[model samples]
Structures are given as C-alpha cells and as structure tokens.
Target: MRRGIGLAAVLVIGCGGGSEPGGIVPLSEEPAYAVVLSDYTSTAIAMVRADGTAVDERWVTSGTETPGLVAALSGDVAIPSAGLGDGTLWLLDRFRTDVLTRIEVPSGEVLGQVRTHDAGEGESGWSSNPHDVALIADDLAWISRFEPNLDPAAPELERGNDLYAIDPSTMTRRGMRIGLSQYDVEVAGADGTSATAFARPSSIVRLGDVLVVGLARLTVAFDGAGPGAIAEVTIATGETRLIELEGLHDCARVVPAGERAIVGCAGFGDMAGKRATAGIAVVELVDGHVEITRTLRFGDDEQLPVASQGVVHVDADRVLAFEWGAFDPATPDRLFEIDLATGSAVEIASSAGPFELGSPLFDGAEDLALVPDASRGLRRFVRGEDGTWSEMDAIELATDLALPVRHIARL
Candidate 1:
C-alpha cells in the first residue's frame, strides 16, 4: 500500500537523469543502503551500488498504519512497531519478511497483538511510544521510550519515562527510570517540588559501556521553560550523573580525541523564541566519569546551538547537526558541520532547497544519507573532495518497512 512519488515531486529532485547546479554531487562509489521506516505503511529498504545504482527494493513489514522505527547494526535491522492503545509491542526482522516477533513489556508474553494506551487511564498498560532503539551487543537491546503526553498543556499524572535493557535471548525486561532534576526554578514558581520530580528525558545514545541520556529539565511546565542537560548512566553499574545547563534539548556523541562526549542543547527559550547563550556542550567521558570541558554557543561565543530532532557525532573533531526551522516534522531542515577544536559551526548541506532531508545517516566523515520525504525515498550522501556533498542512488527497502528511522548504523 505504499504510494510512489508523483511526477511533479520527482522532477523537483532531478528524476529522469536530469541535473541541477546546487544539486548534491552524485555518489561515485556505491555503498550499503536502506530506507528509513515512517509509521506502518512499510516504506522502503534498498541497496545501492557505489556509483549510485539501485540494487533492490524490499518490504520489511506487512502491517499498515502502525508507525515503526528502524535501527540497523552488523547484519541485522531492528524494527520496533508502535502499539495502538493496549500495551502491545511488535519487533520485526527487517531483512526477512517472515521473521516477526511481538512482546508485551508489562506482561512479558508473546501475544499476537498488544494495545498501547495512555498512562493515566484506569487500566494499567505499558506505553509502546517507542522513540529510539539501539543494539549494544548481540542479544542485548536498549529501547528508549517517550511516555505519551496525556496533557499536551499540563499533564497531571506524569508516571512513564523509562529505558529498558532487554535481553533479546530471554525476552526479559531489565528496565530503569531515566529522569532529571531542575534546580533553576524561579522562587515564584517553586512549591516544595524538587527539580528531579518533573524532569522529561528526550533521547538516549549508547557509547561503548556508557549510556548518555538527554534530559530537558523543567524551569516551568507545559511551556517547556526549563534548563537542559544530559545525564550519563553507566550501563554496567546503572549509576547516573547529570551534566547541568540552562537551556538544552538533545545530546550527541562521545568524541574519541580527548575521549569527550559532545552534546547538543536546543538553546531556544520557547518554541519560537530567539537563540540563547548556551550551545553544544563538550564533556570528557573517561573510564566512567563525565566532566564538561567547554560550551560552544553561537556568534562571538563562536558556537551554533544544535536544534533537536537530528544530530550525529561521527568523531571528536567532526559532528553533524540538524538545524530545524520549526518544531513541525514537516518544517524544512538544514545540516551543519561543527568543529570541536575551534568551537564553530558552518552550514554544510540542506534539504529544504533542492532535496528534502529527513533523518540523516552519518557513516563517518565522508559518508551520510538523507531520507527524502516519503514522496522521493532515501538519498545517500558522501562527502566529495572539493568541500561539496554529493548524492547516490535512491535506496531500496522492504515493501513492508513500517517505521520512521530513529537512528542509523552502517553494517
């Protein structure tokens, strides 16, 4: 039930072997490729030749309407399907169409289907609002869950923010609660509520043995007027440490140069307000200790604050950041290259102009992929010699690919 792109949108992205001046340089050497899953309509998964030739298009899932997220590592692609309102969870084998498994986190059972429901309701159920998934080791799956916002304005019963370290071999759930504390609350708003009581964690990234979780601390409720920071939780011991900040959103990666972890804090005061003083925070993660070394802000501070929704740290020195024009998923996006050594940001590529870039795939310093809006499929990007970015062939994916891409890892 996947809809192919219309002739008009295809032409805008240079279909029929056409060319444009500001176009991404065509990919010269084909590499492994796949399409990001958007919800249950089974998007696309494909392999591309080094010179940008489409090798195949396969459907990874069969369910429609249920959005899924894809995470590919080694030789396996992990696809987690979102449940409706009954606490049911679905996991699909993206490479093989016949391989699919579903589980209920709360009940620990292999049911045909489970329902996803709001947290504050009468019946008890686990929220399948799966935001991100990562495969830390063979048999171990780390799933990040964003609890459903019952009150888009002001949620009364806030109970569900968690990270599960599941052993895929046993189907057992090893879970931990991920949250933050706000110390910067104004006196007028303070009411004996500790900062840790109402912290909302957004994303999580696992670097080796350390799991770095992004926390949006609340300075105020509903409005999301709060200080932002990243919490580093050790996977082995489960001990957590918080990196505090005034305004922040997402965190990036652990650079290997000084063995530092780079985080992107959304510096926007409100959804539409101007950028503030804080930018990307580079902290050193050694052994199991986390310390902030520098804060890269925009302008004289020579730092460009990273907009949330998309960010990738390829290495210590080079990082890929997505500058979101608006909070809307449909809003246009831009990619910036941040240099950690000098603490500066330079716009490298953009999807708003010629091609629309959705979730980006950063293979390394020279490789990246931009999933064009469902209309056009996935476009691969590989850095060229002249400080330019080029595109390869369109990605082929499973006809049943059912998830939006949460993150990408090259096999």
Candidate 2:
C-alpha cells in the first residue's frame, strides 16, 4: 500500500559508476553448476542437476524456435531464442548442454526486428520481442527487445522498445535506443495525455556504465492497471532516461542488489476495484535520476496475488522474488522473502504454481535458491545461517515432462 511515483530529476551522469563486480564464473562453466530450462513450447533445453538432477533428457538448443529466456554466460548458455517465436539467439554449451551456436541476429538488423508482429522482420509492423539476456562485459553482451508496439488502432497504446549490444567477440548486434519505448514522456505530469504510451522492456541489469532497465507501463486508464518504469542506459553512451514507478506493473525481474534495483512486478491480477501494479521495485541511481526507492506490496489485499517471476540478488539486503501465478495453480505461487534493508516481505518459499512457470536461480553454493517448479520439478531452497528459507529436494525433468514453462537460467 505505498505508491510514490516521484522523480523526474535528471542530472547525474558525470561518467557512469556502478557495474564492476563479477561472479557468475565467466568461462570455466561455473554458473552455479547447472539448471537452465526454457522449453517455451518445447524443443529441448532442460539440463537440471545442481542437486535438482534431470540430467539432460534433451538439451537441444533450438531447431524449431520457441526457447524464450536463458543467458547464464561463461562457458556458454545464452539462449534468447524468442525470435518472436521463430526463435534464434542460442549460444549453448555451458558445460555440455548440447551444441548450438547462433547470434548472427539478422532479419531487419534492428528496429526491433519487425518480421511480422512477433517475428517482426519481414511483413509485420513491429516485433522487437527479444526479452532477456545479459553479460555486461567479458566480451560484452546484452539483449532485450520487447516494448511499446501496440497500436491495434488503440488498445491503450504502446510503441517502443529495442536495446541490443552483443559482440560475443563478434556475433554482432548494436542497436540501443537506451530504454526504447519512452513514447512522448511526461509521466506523473500527465502532460502527455495521461501517460500509458507504455514502455515494456522486461528485464536487464548492470550498474557501472549504467544499463538499469525493467519496465511495464499502463497508467492512464485501462482498469486492468499498469505502472512500472526504470530505464537508465548509457553503455558507452546510448544515454537514455526514465524512472517512473508505482507499485510496479508487469516487469518480472531486474536483479542487482548492492546499488539497488530489484524489481519483479507482474500485478494486473485481481482488478475488482482495479489497482494492480503488483509488487517490488526498489530502484536507485540518484542525482541524475532513477529513484523508486521502494514499493514491495501485498500486505493483504488478500495476499498471494503478486506476479513476480525469477529474481536473484540474495545479499546486500536480500531478494528472491519469483511468484508466477498467472498460470494459476489456484493463483498463489510464493517465494518472496525480500527485505531491501527494511521494506519487509515474507512468504519464504512455495511454488508449484500449476503453470506460468516459477523462476529463481542463484545457488552460487552456500545460500542456495534455484527453482523451476512445474509441479515441483527442479526446486531447492536452503538459506538459514540466520536469515531463513527452507525446502530442498526437487528434480523431475523429462524435458519439462508436461511442458508449458519458458525461462530459467544459471548454468
């Protein structure tokens, strides 16, 4: 029950300062052992085993599109294969997860790769639906293209998104509009009609050269609710800005704790009275802009109504959001346990949501946390030292057995 929506400041980009702590292994394949599921529609790419054990029934990178999200980088595993569904961005092999190599991102090059709506690169008007993939440096890589582009004549409205800068030593793709779908801008002031031109990029996080993206907007009038923003790109100088949030709207995951920014909103559920922005958005980046500070909701609108999905961060103040209830297993999916210093939040752990596919992956050893829960297939929680969180054994992947998942990484 807290919705600030403040900050339009702008002025803090002296040079950029906050992205320099690396530890996902980087190259000898230590992304926490292994657990990369993205059977978006199914084609293979399961690989469980860090304790969850599924042992590769078919890690087939991609051959029929639909791989969705995954980017564990180091010795491999960069799968973004959502070419809107035609799929293609796989880089696999993060320690024998099957061989796949493709990052030649070409079709329209970049404008959001508009092939035809979701594959937008040929006949369709807008598509840039890339969604998730990041490395920051170590050869450089970052991908996220899912924004604005709504125009069904007037379905609330949205028309923006595109941010790619992958070199992978030279796989290619340099298209950054910063955050990409700012539309006309002027949130809070409502000057731009009332807001809601939307800005939908979903997840991305980096602090040093700036980067910080995680958005999902809708505010002005739709009843279903919408409001979530944080787009601060400056990777070498794409120089963009936008920080407007309120409880958050659709974001899904934007990890990175020390410098702040742990959004995982998805709200938009129980709209009886209509005010669903969902929860969590603690952002940062002061002086120049970007400041949501804190939002974490669900104190009891009835509880168990969030939408979050796969977030990490676990230290600096804790984080582990993941509650993908949309597939509705009765619509409760848990695993919250936030604490950004003091904003509080509990739930501890619980997922088997029935379908949208639970999502959280950390397990760098010690504190542990890795779930893929499709009825409890690859779960594992273990925190305790003083902090708390339990529930360990889970491993039943026959290639997602029943299927329907669509994202989960940490190889």
Candidate achieving the largest lDDT: 2
Model 2 lDDT at residue 31: 22
Over the full model, what C-alpha lDDT does candidate 2 score relative to the true structure? 0.49
Weakest lDDT window of 10 consecutive positions for candidate 1: 2-11
lDDT of 1 by residue, 1-411 (tens): 111111111112112121123222223333344343444323333334333344433322221212121121112233331112223233433322212234332222333221122334542333434444455554455554444333444232233344545544443344433333322233223454543323445455555577666654443343434455666777777677777754443332222232455666655454334355336666665665776777765533524544433445656666666665654445556677777678666675555432245545565544654544433455566776554566576553443333333333232
Q: Highest TM-score: give the candidate number.
A: 1
Per-residue lDDT tens digits for candidate 2, residues 236-347, read: 7677876766555556357766677677766564643223556666777787456777666653355444535566667766677655444533764667866656656688
TM-score of each: 0.60, 0.30
- Candidate 2, residue 25: lDDT: 10
Q: Candidate 1, 306: how far from true, in Å?
A: 6.0
What lDDT score belongs to each candidate, Candidate 1 first?
A: 0.44, 0.49
